[model samples]
Target: MAVTKRVVLHFPRRLVEQPVIYRLVKDYNLEFNILRASITAEPEEEGLLVLQLKGEQEEYDRGVKFLLKSGLKIQSLSQDVTRNEARCTSCGACVTLCPPGAFVVDPKTRQVNFDDEKCVACGLCIKACPPRAMEVHF
Candidate 1:
């Protein structure tokens, strides 16, 4: 039987919207539905982003593993702030480097706003960061 379960992915403030998540979905052939996702905290630059998801058991387990291997910090819905606020200096490295366009720079404020819905939680930004600002919330 295909058992379905509710899962919430608490993405770190950084690298929330990247290609790693999509890759996991496609690679595992998992059926997923996003329940809720947002920056749900203050100082968007240094806050926690929440991603609520529902999917099959096997697929979901694989998805969780995939996310872990990809370097994303995962947290159940019950646990909040699994990771810490990112101290990115808006270096613009992740902006162009992110394939899914997860990192965007505000030319006006030069602050980076990580969109969790768009993020796949790939660690490219984490590796690319010179200041080591991006944190993975697992």
Candidate 2:
């Protein structure tokens, strides 16, 4: 069986410069789609990356375990973005900030389409939505 999961990874300073994604792809044979990233070798902060991994169930499980054993903080994501229909104006403000184009405007109806599958919980939509229609959890 095939499955995909979104998770947040926090890299310690020691592993900040490592090719973590490359390892996940080459060793685990997992497909990694980076949704959001701010990883850097900075003095004040740890590296952070939000991504979705796709592969066989067993491989996915082992890959997550490998990440944990490698000292990377891995938190599986539940739901990323949600929208309140009544509060939305379909103004398309969030379309620009969304990296994955999750918030798309339907040209036929001039309505906004909120595809949860495409969202990675980047949290940029929360501030970009003028009416605060979009909410982000974690």
Candidate 3:
């Protein structure tokens, strides 16, 4: 079966220049979508990458093992971005800011709806929410 997972990868200075993603694809036969990345050219700086990876379950496991052996610190992006219904005023502030379109406005009721499955935990909603209804649990 195929599986998809979001993960954060921290690359030490030594591995910053390596083609880790390329290896994941070529060697492990895994596909990835890079959500965000910050890697400086300076040799002294470390790199950070957020990715959504997909592959067969066994291939995914092998890819993870490869990452660990390559000296990358990996963390599952299981962080939750939640909305407090009580505090939510149905304002559509989050609708435009959410990268994944996790928030939508109900046309009939003019109420805002949130889909947790669509959230990517980018935290943009938390900062944009006027009522402080959005919360991030890391």
Which candidate number would show the highest lDDT if scored against the true structure? Answer: 3
Candidate order by decreasing TM-score: 3, 2, 1
My TM-score estimates for the predictions, one after another, are: 0.42, 0.69, 0.74
**Candidate lDDT values, in order:** 0.59, 0.84, 0.86
Model 3 per-residue lDDT tens digits across residues 1-138 = 999898878898888779999999999999999877888887777798888999999999999999999999887765556789999999798898888998989899999999876777777889799999999754
Candidate 2 local accuracy as lDDT?
Answer: 0.84
lDDT of 1 by residue, 14-106 (tens): 555576557756776655655445554443543233444445667778888877775666665433212234566666777888766877778
Q: Weakest 10 consecutive residues, lDDT, candidate 1?
A: 76-85
List ranges where model 1 is wrong by over 4 Å.
1-86
In model 2, where do residues sit more than 4 Å from their true spots? 79-115, 122-124, 133-138
Compared with the true structure, what per-residue lDDT tens digits does model 2 show for residues 37-125?
88665777788888889999998888888899889988776454678889999999998888878878888998888888777887888
Q: Clashes in model 3: which pairs?
A: none
Model 1 quality (TM-score): 0.42
Better of 2 and 3 by lDDT: 3
Best model per TM-score: 3
